[model samples]
Target: MKIIAGVIIVISCSAMLKKDDVVRQAFDHAAKQTLVMLKEVAIKLQAAKAESKNPMPVAPRTLKDGDLVVVPSRDWTSGFFSGVLWYLYEYTGKKEWLDEAKKFTAAMEQEKWNGKTHDMGFKMYCSYGNGYRLTKDATYNDVLVQSAKTLSTRFRPITGVLRSWDHSRDKWSYPVIIDNMMNLELLFFATRSTGDSSFYKIAVSHAKTTMKNHYRADNSSYHVIEYDTLTGKVLKKNTHQGYAHESAWSRGQAWGLYGFTMCYRETKDKAFLEQAEKIAKYIFSHPHMPADLIPYWDYDAPGIPNEPRDVSAAAVIASGLYELSLYSPNAKDYRAKANTIVQNLSKNYASPVGGSKGFILLHSTGSKPANSEVDVPLSYADYYFLEALLRKDKLEKTSYKSIQ
Candidate 1:
């Protein structure tokens, strides 16, 4: 009996080692493929920049009718490509990636003062924020602080939330989309870097206000919530990119999940942590969630199985879950779900190596209702996918408690 027990233990250890190797191989393959694809993207972006009259190309957003759609630094998604480059630099420690990241990140520095839109965080933080985190460049520090100031300008003390859009005034007086939750990270970073409690206060206020108003009874988030700035009351709950006002927009839900998890990390507030867990429960327990964990563009979209899978949403959820697992009591379940998401994204959603015009993953829906960027590879999808992979690798190799 003793001999048999010893053999069982040995076999179990061997299987564990084999599983680790397989996970490592998956990460390695993803890294290699990403490097190859982004090189081609860099070459194409150069040509586009040379030909275009607009600002220099910051990143590739997606394919439009099989053509690469590169956008300028002003675009909200401009920072994601730079973030991806930074992630590659983090993973491989390659000088080439470092140089590329700096170049693209520099393009976004001027946006620190562009207060026309509320995407200052998406534009500056994802670029300069990552750059600063990696290299601690003093120049990036000023850029981030200025960016946070610009973002703060959108915040209304009455509303207790930052305004999301300046356009569509007739439709919404003070629109606060669920996506705005993501920009709070810039505020939190600013406070930490400068010891300015105002930035922290604003972030906390926004998170608290959003937590109070953005979620349904089931914890699913609305895509847009318009506020009466005068009274600080929610005027309407609407949907610009979702299927309906009442439907669960997959990407919106993902943004909330990631945003709250990050808020908890920065604030150590149990409310934010609990909100993150609730959002996670809503996402994973949805009856419509695909078996592989990728979700359709919207949970209540007319078509179910036939709807386009939003790989971007899956990437964001996976990344968020990895972080949430570190703080939640259900750490094991969260980690397992995150692992499954990464595995499925790597195995099923990844673009063919050397294909898809250098984008990493395919079949992302940016805004299906608007007939824009449907069933295509988005830059943000690739960024979050790389982030999730890195988080997984870090968690696996180090003790989670030590990381905290």
Candidate 2:
């Protein structure tokens, strides 16, 4: 009885910290974890180089078969590890993190000209975009602009969408996954960089088209939209990575929410803001949302407690909500929701010190429907989780000043 009372008191005290204090502690924990990750990755890179015949550099993706998995430049997730490093540099102002980030980012330079994939924004922009934003580096700006041009090539004027994949034509003639919404950030930056609105125009067109066709009545987005390339008609709405044809894939919703919120930020378009809010309402009001605010791999996934939780989705949504709160009239509610997500993730999903194979968060399901990356620590999860921490810190500072 005495021990139980002691535990209850500890829990009560932990729950009583101010939101800013919780965020500060989360950031400190994340900083230490990032340093450990950097060191582990460095060791893994050295081992991979020693074993590779070509000695090409690689970025860590996740743990596979009990070893750190490193992906080459062409992999879709290749840039996220570097992006995480950049955030760590921003958060900690540590020269070592910046130097390591530069090295990993430079390795992706050649991908700026690779137009075969729709992931140029993920491969180039996430690394160089953050790099340029943080350091004002002209070289990083050039890479980002070129990547935007390369990504633009994938956009079909007739379809009004960027082609997400080429080989799945039997599934879609010109496939445009909801995830492509994320790539618009590169194009928006290009317009600001080059004084050419072509990139901006394409970004807006894609967003408008996606807004028209991708969402269900509940505002939950489908995972993939197949278009007739010649006629600007949607061939099908499919859930390639979701549990069912009509199910809401958790990460897809996160991408849509983040992307539209970003669109509003770049253009200040009221329509985009409304769309973001609608999506947020759908997600937050959904019955499947766990009491902890973490969601299953799919909101409609058949299993509940037995199903994998998507920490990546939670991270992305938390980051998006923090940004959305700054712009929305319902700022307090959005910030409070975001605060809850960040606090829950920091306490529950975050890997213990020296655990998770040097990754930060765990239990992210990449594509459970496809039977890939189930219950693992993903690089993008860490990237967005760090982003949420930084945004929360920024919001706290802003609120403190307003109070003063």
How does model 2 score by TM-score?
0.92
State the displacement of the C-alpha of residue 152, model 1, in Å, after optimal TM-score superposition. Answer: 0.6
Please give the distance, in angstroms, between residue 329's alpha carbon in candidate 2 and its true position after superposition: 1.6
Clashes of 2: 0
Q: What tens-digit string does per-residue lDDT give for candidate 1 at 202-318? A: 999999999999999999999889999789999999999999999999999999999999999999999999999999999999999999999999999888989999999999999
Per-residue CA lDDT of candidate 2, range 1-404, in tens? 99999999988777655655776677677677777777777787787788873635468788877677877888899999889889888877989889989999999999999898998888888899999989999999999999999999998899988889877766777889999999999999999999999999999999999999999898999989888867989889998879998999999999999999999999999999999999999999999999999999999988877899999999999999989987888888988888889889888988888776678898899889778889899999998988888887776767622211
Winning model by TM-score = 1
* Candidate 2 Cα misplacement greater than 4 A, ranges: 1-17, 53-57, 400-404
Worst lDDT 10-window in candidate 2: 395-404
Candidate 2: which pairs clash?
none
